[model samples]
Target: MKQTGAIVSVADVAWIIALWVNRSIHSSMKTLKWLLNLDFEQQMNETEKIKRAKQIAIIAGVFTAFVGVLLLLNYLQIKKSDPLNSLVLEKLVERLSSEPNNQQFVEEIRQVDLLMRKAYFTSLWQVRTGAYLMLLGAIVLVLSLRVYYGLRFAIDQPSADQIKEKKKRQLTQRWIGISGALVIILAIMSAFFTMNHLRSYEPEKMIVHSKAGDESIEQLEIVSIRTSETEIDTVIITESTDVEVKQPEVAITQQPEMVVFNEETVKINHNAFRGSWGNAVSSSTNLPTSWDGATGKNILWKTELPIHGYNSPVIWNEKLFLSSANTSKRVVYCYDRNSGKLLWEREVNNIQGSPATQPKTTEDTGLAAPTLTVDGEKVFAIFGNGDIIAFDLNGNRVWAINLGVPDNHYGHSSSLLTWEKKLFIQYDTHSGSKVMALSTETGKTIWETVRTNDVSWASPILAKVDGKFQLIMLANPNLSGYDINTGKQLWSVDCMSGEVGPSPVYGGGLVYATNEYARMVAVNPKTGEKVWEDNYYLPEVSSPAYHNRYIYIATTFAVVACFEAATGKFLWEFDAKNSFYSSPMIAEGKVWVFDTGGKAYIFESGSEPKLISSPELGEKVFATPVFADGRVYIRGVKHLYCIGVN
Candidate 1:
């Protein structure tokens, strides 16, 4: 009996130890599962569970506080490095506010403004990202604390009815999760619709030009505003006097490449377009009439220029010369004709009239608005400050002369033209305007004819009229002709009025002159009398080009109008869909019209205006293209392009 009692006691002790071991294993399994999904199950003692819950709450609080500190640091960093402090933005705004009429300045301001705003918004998004991360961490930490406390010290004992109630509560929680997900989905859809609705532009607001006095200029303002959920795009045009505001074309479409013919070799003509009245008929039979810049077809080479200018390039033999200037410096550039490589550049630093001393010029009438003239022996260039500098064939400065600061309100823009061995310059300022002929070799004043002229930007043309070479020029009140050899006034007429920008084109024994706010008149160059006058469409800046009896004018309003040279009859016209600043050139039985937005439109100059092809260079073009030596040279705001095939 005694042995049995001892064995029973041992078995009882073994059972107690086994029960303790099983309890520990079950507790560890429950703790591991709870850590994996944060869903602890199984009954626990009150004091121990409370202690565990307190530890979890402390850890969660610490974690949430740490995340909050990180979020705060991110916000402070973003504020410290704000985009408003950028130097580029300051410079752009300064220039934009000063030159209110400069389109290039406005464009640069818009681009920089966009980039800065993007950076600002990107910083904001980064802060938001940190905020989101912090919120998630806080939510997780808060839930962990709440659950830890709620489950701790709860009663483990329950009846059958209590169990049923618990199951119902679990079912409700499942439904709540499902509803929360649906709400999140609905919120996302709403935000997407809101974004799309906000990303749209209203119609443009156009302001009509005020009808002021004849000498009074009117300021017109046009604004385009587009709103999006994330940003706003606003374009403002503040100052415009005679400009007619039209919306730019909506799209730039890509076209197929046009084949450039090169089967036959083309002969180089040095004197082609040497004068303003560039060969009325092109001798380039194999030149490309149509090209696509986007496809890189027939574009032999393009070289980036260093300065800004409205001066067209001049070609002589195998060299190309161009002039450019800014507020402080002037540069004359030379390039190789075949390779489009810049051979040399010379800078003339002895600028007489400081840019500030000169009167305010229109955006188009920049420091270098006049086209360079070359006579194989020498190249000549003129600036808005009445500075004329001559260079040799190898880009060496030959002579420099300052005619004195011009008093014109719109700056000096008369281009240089050469006749025989004399360089012709029409210095028509507000006062003391004169037409001077300088010797090409020594840059000496060969002949000077002072005239009673107003502030005019007209460049003189050397043409053979009535069996004599006459230099024709136009001003506000009169159109005059001078002898090319002696600077003698051959004839003068009080026929033209308004700011004369269009240089008179002499063809068919008549000189065609037109302006924005004046009548289109056909005058006899010999007698300087109005032969015929028409009140039809006219150009603002672009000069009229003539081919026999057909006269072509591409206006700033983007219309290419044709007229009969003899009778002043209006012919057909075509819309280029963009404004034109560069004058039209007649070449190869086609009329080339280059727009300010860098598009070239070629069409037939005849009774009917037929469409050929429109090529875009993706750059701003303000100078007329030079066609010589079987190649076409174009000057953009930043680059010079030579288009031809070898």
Candidate 2:
């Protein structure tokens, strides 16, 4: 077992020795006074006094020797039972077994091990305060004894002057030692605080300005504009005060009008067809309304999905895969991406629990929230019940495993990620969450690490930092990184405070993460150190999408904010008419975001954004958009839209 607490450690032996030395000196002084005041002038010989002095010195020497040995033993015990080394050994065994041929893997493992040891060792200094208190108590006890004995025995002695002077000197030395020790202790604490603060650096300040001019800022007026196909009108009103202005009237002039014959006309424009959805504050790709026969729009064969699902489709080669579930059955469906035809469906009765009132209670509530991932040969999907199923490209079941029963207030929402031969998933719930890694070939557990706090809806992402790969998860109260091979926690930064939803995005050498009630944070992924944090509250379910050097975040309050990825700086904000749950997807230099009201808003994916188009599908949408082979597939509550050039 590791060290129980910081208190009562091996290094305390030095403190004990110092206390013993002080007590011995005081005892020696007391013994000398007793010997001198025993009528020694008339009855005692010179040799007797010399013998008593020698005895007192011998006693002090023996006491000091005993304290020195105790101190040595304590140090030896601490070295032998170091808990940091033991934990490192456990992690090293797992890493070696997973990647036996990696050249620098062993060295990287050693470095991580050393860092953990240092952290634990540094914690020991916090216990030093208790040791100092013990030393102080010992000093006080020694001084009290010395003062009482000196006054009691030397009341009528002729050499009292000499004894008093010696006492005074000892008192002065004691005060100096106490003061110096306190100063050293405080200095050590201050240095530790300063170093820790410097390591966690904050970014520079940001300034935002309002659109209205300074003269009109005091009485800021909001104008509402209504438009039709032929005309546009605007109206303005102020709540604080009202002012009336005169309107100019002009006489109408009569002009000759020409009569036109009605004819059917077809107008086609590439740029005019791109529309936007979700909260239209962010930018998206321009989707074509039609495409050519082989790879484009209206000419290709189309097919319908077997059942309703919120999960987006995954396409590989010409085949498409998706997961879905109904009241009595859970299934994996395979389809043809070009023809939109269902090829095969695999159904199973894997669910065994009753549904709760909340929409996110179980995987059966919706089989398709967690999208399926393909690693060329096999397709993988994770159910809310912790069921992980794998299927080959030809629709054959390869393997399956259930991690655990996820009992979250809102069911499991994490998607599965694969690295090499391992499948990683974050299973954070109310009943104690954990990040688990499994062998992809057999679905056997590799390693599992318990999360520090409860998690709700966030997913984990794999990120490479400083040439090392780490699996990062945004759990409640913190963003944690773990060794991808061994599931050992490498580093954790406490930046998120509320329910975390956004899957972490890694770009530009920094890992970006945000929580529903907390702010967005950027950190150096390798060291798990915070670079900057901005107090921007977003929705509980929306995830940030990154493109170039910008990040687009959609809040539940119907606002989409664009931010610079490396530094936590807000660039622009857009106001959509409805709240958002669907995440934004970036493609073709634009952002496509869908809202619950079935409106798709397309925006320019740059610093200065402009609205491209707005199209209404007249349905509710909860899933994000997916793009493949120049076609965008959006799943609505009642229909799946295939947008491309016609």
Q: Model 2, 575: alpha-carbon shift in Å? A: 1.4
lDDT of 1 by residue, 1-646 (tens): 2332343344345434434433443454354345435333544554556556555545444443443443344344334544434567678656755565565655565566566556545444434443444344345444544555456415466678877987886698578646644543443343334233322323232332433432122222222222221122222223322121222222324453332212121123333232344333344555665555667677888888878888778766678888888777778888888898888777765533334454567777878888787766567887877678777666556666667678877767888877677888888887677787777765656666677768788777767765677888888877877777766677777777788887777777788788888878888876667888886888888888888688888888889999988898888988876888788877777888789888998887688888788878778888887776467778888888878763
lDDT of 1: 0.65
Candidate 2: worst 10 consecutive residues by lDDT?
264-273
lDDT tens string, model 2, 337-368? Answer: 66677776766433222233223465323645
Error of 1 at 350 (Å): 3.2
CA lDDT of 109 in candidate 1? 57
TM-score for candidate 1? 0.57
Off by over 4 Å in 1: 1-282, 351-359
